[model samples]
Every structure is written in C-alpha cells, then in structure tokens.
Target chain A: MSEFEIIRDIFAPLTATAPGAFNLVDDAALLEQQNLVVTKDLLVAGVHFLAKDPLDLVARKLIRANLSDLAAKGAKPLGYFLGCVWPKHTDRASIEQFARGLAEDQERYRIGLYGGDTTVHSTKTGPLTLSATFLGTPPKQGMIPRSGASLGDDLYVSGTIGDAGLGLAALRKEFKFTTVDKASLSSRYHLPEPRLTLGTALAGLATAAIDVSDGLIADAGHIARACGLRAEIDAVAIPRSAGAASWVAAQENRWRALATLASFGDDYEILFAAPPAMRRSITVASKASRTEVARIGTLSRGEGVLFLDEAGRPIPVEKPGFNHFT
Target chain B: MSEFEIIRDIFAPLTATAPGAFNLVDDAALLEQQNLVVTKDLLVAGVHFLAKDPLDLVARKLIRANLSDLAAKGAKPLGYFLGCVWPKHTDRASIEQFARGLAEDQERYRIGLYGGDTTVHSTKTGPLTLSATFLGTPPKQGMIPRSGASLGDDLYVSGTIGDAGLGLAALRKEFKFTTVDKASLSSRYHLPEPRLTLGTALAGLATAAIDVSDGLIADAGHIARACGLRAEIDAVAIPRSAGAASWVAAQENRWRALATLASFGDDYEILFAAPPAMRRSITVASKASRTEVARIGTLSRGEGVLFLDEAGRPIPVEKPGFNHFT
Candidate 1:
C-alpha cells in the first residue's frame, strides 16, 4: 500500500475528533486557540542521508526539513524538540559536533532547542536516528492549508527545483560534472533553504501551500487532490538552477530529463496556490521576502495532475513522487 | 561521558534564551503564555524494547512513555505527534495492529493523534524507531518543576516501584516466577500505567515532581541534584508489589536485592516532593485520584541520595540507576 492509503485507512482514525489534526492530511497541525502550529519529521542515516555524512550537516538538514513544513503553513517557528539516537560507542567529539550544528541552525533560524531525548543505540550497528518536533506560531492572518486551493487558482513555487536531486546524484557519483556544479548541487542537497519569510508573506495571499519535499509534481498533486482539483503544469515552466538546466541540456530526451527532475524529491521550496488576480501581490511579497517565485501551473476542475510539454503534448511520468511505503 | 554531562556540556547551550526550556533540565518544556507543555521521547526496538515484541504493545509503550513525561509535570495531555519508522517489509497487518494500540490509548486517555511522519527504513536491518511529541496543558495551579523541591519537602512516590524492573527480569528469563507472577510482571514491562490523575491532583500540592523511569533512586537524585539538596530514603518505605516483595524475600542479601530493585528502571510512577505540612492534603488527593502514594524519602541540605536501612544506616548501592549513555 502507498503511504497515503496507510495514512487514510489505518492511521486517520487515530486522529479522532481533533479538527486541528486535519485528518492527517495537512503538513502541520494547529493547536486551536493557542495560535500554535506543530510539525514532526524523522530521518535515519543511510536512508535519509549517507551514514558517513558529517554530523553537523546532518543536523542542519534535519532541522531544515521540519522548518520547511512550518514555512509551508506560514508559521514562525518558536522552538523544536529533538530526539536523537546516536550509534553505540559514538565519541563525545562527534556528539559535540552535532550540537555545534544544531547551535548554528538555532542561531540562523532564531529558534531554540526546547527539550528532547538523546540515547545511544544498544547495538553497535544500529543507525543514527533523529526526529524533530517543531513548534511555531501561525501568522495573524492564519496558517494556509494545502486543501484551501480553488479550481481557478494559479500555482507558484519558490526558488528552483531539481538542484537538490542532481546534487544527490552527484554525491552518489552517478554523473560527472564540473567541480563548481558538483559542489553547488551537493550543497543544495545538504543544506536546503526553507523559505520561511516568503511563506509568511504569502500567508494572506496564497489560498493553499505545501513544501516541495516529495518532488514538485507530487506535492502539487497533494494540493490538487486535497482540494479536489486537477493541477496542470508546463514542464518547461518548472524553474531550474543553472546547473540543473545544464544537466538537462546534456540529456538525449529533454522532456524525459525534465520529468525526472520534477519527480526527484528534497527540494525544500514552497509550492503554493493563489488566484490569478493576486499575481502582482505575490510578486511584491516575493520581492519583499527576497525569495524568487515562479508561476508554473493552474488548478482546474478535475482530478490528478497533467504534465504538458512546450507544444502542449503530455509527458508520461512513470513515478511522480517518493513514497516510503509503496 | 554520561548522558547528563553530554546534555549539560553540549546540548544545553542550544536552549539559548528559552527560559521555558529550563536549560534542558526539565522533563517537559513550557510554551510561555500558551499554558501548553510539551515533551518528546524516542524509542528504538532492541534498545528500548525487545524487537520481537508485539507491534500493538510496542505502540502503547511508545505513547505511554511520552504520557509519563506529561504526568511528571502534572499536565493534562492534549494530543501528540507520532513519528514512526517502520521496519522494511513490515506487513500491513503489523501497522494496523500498531494503529489499533494507538486507538485504544487515545480513547483511554482522552487524547488524539495530531500529525507526524511515517517512513519505512531504507535497510531491512534498521531498527523500528518511534518518537512521540506530546502536547499538554498544565493544571490551574501551574506545572511542577523538578527543581522546586525544598530542603524539608517529603519525597513521595505514587504506585508501587520496581515492579516494571522485576517484570523486565522475568521477561529476560533472568529469574523464575510463578506463571501468574511472570505474566503480571511481563505485562508491567510491556505496559506501564502513567499516573496522570495523581500527578494532576498533586500539581498544587507537590513542590517538585518527576516520573520514575530511571529507577527510584536515580530519579530521586535528579530531584535532589536539581534543587541542590539531598534525598534520604527509608529502604523499608519503598513500596513494592506482592511479587516483587516475594522475590526480595527469596534473595540471600535483602539489602542488595532491594538496592537492585531500586536501581531498575521503567517504573512509570510519579516521584514527587511536597512540603511536610501538606501530608494530609497529599493523602486526600491521592485517595481522590485513586492512586496509592508512599512517602519514601525526605529532602535535606547537601547533595546526592541516601538509601537507609531500618536502623538509619546508609546501604551501599553500586549503581543507583539506568543510564542510556555511560
């Protein structure tokens, strides 16, 4: 079963009568009357990142991953509770390095570590597992939900997609690139920039929003499916970094390459929906937040998603997203 | 380095200016002005519990552990975000069983599941990791802090201590017991009852409180150390279940056996301190909450903890409690 089916059929009932839970459909949950929004994400070494990856970068990546969720809902993060299980016999220096990483991000995000647990795995071979529960205050205009999109809403995304995917590919030595390109891409994978400011700015403007962690097309589909609308996107209109564009240029089938990029996960950018009439306002908000925004699609009265090429020809995507359980 | 040192020297600084974090010393953190309290706990199969345990029981253990933290702070649990990393190849039935456990507890505790991530481990051998971030509301009298214990405060514990520890021993086959005793002990290890009602009732009366997860003596030390005092316990005063008392009676060295039992972890009972003047009030509250209470010790000037015999002689304890990292 897919992750969605598991959540909907097996786990959704656990949510009971809590309306803030959103029936486990939204990226974050609201604490009614407290104006608080909360989100949690767990990462395991070798699954989410290389087991040998530097502890500091791993720490930052974990923090950013959850922050990206809050950003999607226009929540200003207050603090996070961290749950870390280090591998057995991990040295103090390594743990200190991890703390240094948390300190760096804590300063950058202006959030504190509220409280958490740290335990060393009992088995030497056990993986480094980490979980962060982030708490934030929603914008006064209120947090945006992914299911609030309307049929006529125009979809926009912050920053570029595919760079992080390419970066992962480069890290695995799947493809060779220039030193600069490789470094840039690798950095993108290691340190995703959560568009917090942009999300907060768009809270009152965007009808719906979600973070692009499970690929652009998949996340856009989330917004579409939640609102019972079809999302139509121009493949070429999906923003890309210069390196990503160069990589696509070298591929035999440009459409296929672009689709692959759109299907790759880990781009922690905001994918949001707004009315076409709010385009100018979105531009102003994006500029004010110093985040690049691109309009790539529109929601229509239908279901699922449509990926169209420059000539309006549909491109087939075998897999449109990442699902932990398939 | 011990877990406490690692937390104090490295992780504590990350708390920064968040006073609610209590410098990462408290079991739960307060969200200033929100009247909300939050706590997080992580459990890994093979470390926190046997990997072969039933999925439903494991699920309950995870939820109860976090709820135990809330109980220590005298908070009424609102809901929780659950982060689960299921083992690869896990069957749908297993996950369904896990959700069933959660459903059972949500109804029992009047709490709901909020939101969280569910991912399958990339490797088959990876441990089944789970985390729960619980949110709660403090009583009208405000939540009790572990550091609030006074020199003359009486150290009391709700429910019998060491039963869960003895239960673990029975499960491990380190000891032989009657079939009924074994089942009872094993159940205690698998499912701990969090003293929520007692904790809530004691909020206005108890000067300090903490859950007895890391053995009775170690937890008492936590309160004493936090408040810059010493805790002196009358060995005979520590409450024990019928099976535990019988087991202790069979040991060659009564003091050693008692010490061993006190050193075992996972009791899930609330260990707290209240002024001596509130003894009557505490008794009334305990009866009203339907929770048994035992005055095990007293707080005094100085540091550390003293486990004393009937004649007031201090008994030596080689190891006071369980430490995840040492």
Candidate 2:
C-alpha cells in the first residue's frame, strides 16, 4: 500500500467523533475554547535516543518529554500532534510497533491522537525524527508561568536530581554500574516519568515551575531569568539517588561526578518554587502522592543562578545547561 | 553560542503568555473550548523541497501546509506548534532566517507561536526536518466533515490544480514551460495559499470539505470513501492555469496532464460538497471573495472516484491520488 493508503487503513478505523475532535483531514484542528496551552518537542534518533532503542521506550520517552512540560505548569493533557519521518529501511512490522507504542502512550496520558503526518525518505543517513505537540488545559486558577517566581521563594524539585543524567553517563560508558544499579540507571534514562500529579498539586502553591530537561542548575537558571530573580542552590541539599552516595564515595573524581549529575539533560523532573508558608501544604500533597519532594535552594533578590557549596562558597561552572545550538 | 543558548536568546525574549497558545515549554497547551480541529504535517529536506530552498519559502510552506487542513474543514486559524531539527552544520544566520520567516508567517495568519523544540542531529546526509501542528476553531455550526457528503451534492474546488505538481515536473526536466508558465508554476510549488477565506465562508454551505493536498481525483476519493459514496467528475470543468491548457493542447496529452494534476499533492485548495440548493449562496460567496468556484462533479450512491469525459465516458487511470507509503 502507499503512504496515504496505509495511513487511511490504520487511522480510519481508529477515528471516532469525540465532542471536540476536529476533522482530522482539515487544514488545522480546532479547540473548543479560547484558553489553550500548547507545547512542542522534537526527538531525533541518535541525539535524543539511539536508533536501536526499543520502540516502546522511544514512544514513552517522547510522550514523557512533552508531558513533563505540562507537569511543570499543572496543565491537563488534552491531545497531541505527532510528526514522524519513517526511515526507508523500516519494515511494516517496525512501523506497526511504533504505532502501537504511540497508541499505548496516548491512552496512558488520556490524550487523543488528534492528527499527525508521516513521511518516508530514501536517504540512508537521516535520523528517525519524531515531533509531538501536546495540547492541554491551563490550571483553573491560571497557569504557573515561568515568570511568576518571586524573591525569597523556596526552590523545590519533585524528585531526585541527576539520576537521568547519571543514567546517560553510564550509557555512554563514562562510568560502570553494578547489575542492580545498571537496571535502575537504564530505567531512568529510558523512562523518566513526568511528575504530573505533584505538578498539578503545586499549581497554585508554586510561584513558578519548569521541567528539568537540561540539568537542574541550567533549568533553574531559566526560572531565575524568566522571573528576574536570582536562584541560590545549596549543593549539599541537592537530592541524590539511592546509589549515588555509594558511587560518589568510591569515585576518585567525586566533584566531577557531582558536577555531571548537576549538568546532564533528560531529567524530566519538575523544579518549582513556592513561598515558605506553602511548605506545609506542599509536604502534605507530596505525601499524598507518595512522591518525593525536596527544597534545594531559594530564589533571592539578585539575578542569575548561583550554586553554593557546603561552606557557602559559590562554585564556578563553565556552562549552566545543555546548549542545543552548540 | 550553543543550541541551548540560541534557543534562549531567540525565544526567551518572545516569551510572554500563550495561556491559550498551547506553547511548547509547558506540559501541554490548554485549549479553552471544545470541538477542536487539529492537524499535523511534516516537511523533509530533499523529499519535500530542495535543501537550498529559500528559508522564507520553507517557513511559509510549513505554515501553509498545515493551514490547508483548517481550510478543508472551513475552520479558522488559532495557533501552531513547530518541531525543527537543525542540521549540525547549520549557522546562526540560517537559524535566524528560518525563525524570522516563521515569525512573519505566524503574524500573517494571526496564529500564535505556542511552543516547539529545536534539536541538532549527527546525521550528515538527512535534509533539515520541520513539522508543524495547527490548531483551529471549528466553524460555529460545526465542521464539514469528509464523511458528510450526500448523493447528488455538487463538488467544487477553491482554485486551479496541478500547477504545483507540474512545477515539480518542470524542475525535474520532465517537461518544459514558457517563462511565464514557469514562474507561475514555481510560485505554486513554493507558496501554496490555504483557502482560509473561502473555507470559512463555505462552512455552512459545504456538507463535506477537504483540502486538496493530494491531487483532485485522489482527494475527491477521500470524500467518496468517507461519505461511502462515489464521485463523478467532469474533467473539462476542472480548473487549470493558462499554461497548463496550452501545454496540453500542444502535446495532445491533455488526459495525461489532467490525470497528473488529479493525482499530485500540495495544492492546498479546498474540494468540497454542497447540496444543490446551496449553489447560489456558494457562487455568491466565491464571487465576493474573488476566488474561482467551479462545479466539477457530483456525489453518487456508490464507492470509488470516477472521472468522465465530455461524453460521460470514464477515463482509465492507474491511481487516484499520491499515496505517502507507496
């Protein structure tokens, strides 16, 4: 079958008249209301993930990456748009597997597969590219914009930092891990879950929030700049994985490993800020969700991001975050 | 600066509030209302267009291609999401030019730039990949779904067809064209204008509508299959450019040329069905909008698409439309 025929056969049966479902073949999809939240993310094979990565894992990662953005602002997933460039060498079975993974992820998120495009090219060297645009509803009160952080607000992260980063490092052979640690680390790299529940819970409580796609320090800098406030992170308080302490203890280059933990991307954790008064409520909600929460720093009156060591000395770093252009 | 820094500098300053914008940075963009119209399109370098295609035209095509979906449903433009993969060797100026083109096109459509991702890849041979998700508001009464066509409904197209496809053929040296024809054909290839105005106007009148991304016969076939009916089109009634007619007349291959026109994609015109009674209103609206309107066919109580010559003889053809998978 041709590309068009395949799409029609696969997607036509999946089509149904949902209340807000757009005419899928139309020029654009229509939303029911005026208040809309949209986000887009692109995943390139090799850079974003290996070409040999499991289709299921790739599908999950793509959705999680986009959902992580929604989690940062406490938005509800409405639906998504997927654009795929299928490699010429990919067989029908592989395509089916990919589609199945996509369907699974969509159901998991309760998001409709509103529309998308798929194209095939003859080029042998192009990476498989998948881009997803997620549509969500803002919080009832409003959204937690990146610009909402205020001076003196407590900075918190929904889960431990650097696990995903460390996972990548391990994947790259920068470090070796025990069998148990290897499984855990690989899971972190393959399926970093978005903290949706905690983010939604903190929507009104958190002054500002952002998903940590780049490293914690780098992403925190985004919040700081957006809100025009300085962020001061205490390195000592930065949460580590269960095995991180042991690994660091055995490492000759402890500082280097620690720094790597703070600089790696792919950590789909939500980093947010809130006033001290909201700490109790945050803790309560965190407990209710059975999710970890930690205060690693504070937003201050200055600008830019600063990391303080145990002795309160500022640590100088070459770069704060992942640079896509570089 | 690195890719990350480039994104920060280019997009950070533009960060305001896309509350309803469904931006990229958030977990998901919120849609204010329901009955959303959503669509996605992917553009791959080499396959879709040449690598050296002007950045402005590339950006315009991205928006226009997606916008065409809205036009098919008689919907209005709302916003869009962009997913881009920057070639590893791409310079800052190229990126800026691309962004500038996008900005201009977004402004033209009154569509907000909600969110998107920028990634760099190691693949050296793949053409730049770009994808866009367009969100639109369904017509007040509702969408003219492709499945809504009824027997005896009149078929119509918003504008001339086959120009873009012919342009491609011309570019490949498969055909020759006069200078005037070449310019017109190339323009059709480079910049397809989505029939937003006509689509909106036809919202109530068109019982079913679809953008003619694929050639007329193929796209019309979509309506036929969707509505579980057959389409009988009068070939002479199909619109054509002046050069197209001349070429056909000169080569005595009018049927072949017409079939090619019927099977090509990227026209971005609306092919719609309307009840016979609504003809007057549609004609008036088309006149007011200064866009040509032609009655090319009728819906029949059958399956498949059929093309008829002046004597009502069926024309033999191998394919009805461009199929993506094949």
* Index of the highest-TM-score prediction: 2
| Top candidate, metric DockQ | 2
Residue A50 accuracy (lDDT) in model 2: 79
The docking category that best describes candidate 2 is medium
Q: Residue B279 in candidate 2 has what lDDT?
A: 88
lDDT of 1 at A88: 80
Enumerate the candidates' DockQ scores in order: 0.20, 0.62
Question: What lDDT tens digits, residue by residue, belong to model 1 across residues A233-297?
Answer: 98999998989999999999999999999999999999999999999999999999999999998
| lDDT of model 1 at position B32 | 32
Residues B184-234 of candidate 1 have per-residue lDDT tens digits of: 888889999999998889988998888888889988887887788999999
Q: Residue by residue across A80-199, what tens digits does model 2's lDDT show?
A: 777789777667777777777767777777777666778886587777899988767777868788778778899998777777766767777878888777678778988888887887
Error of 1 at B222 (Å): 0.5
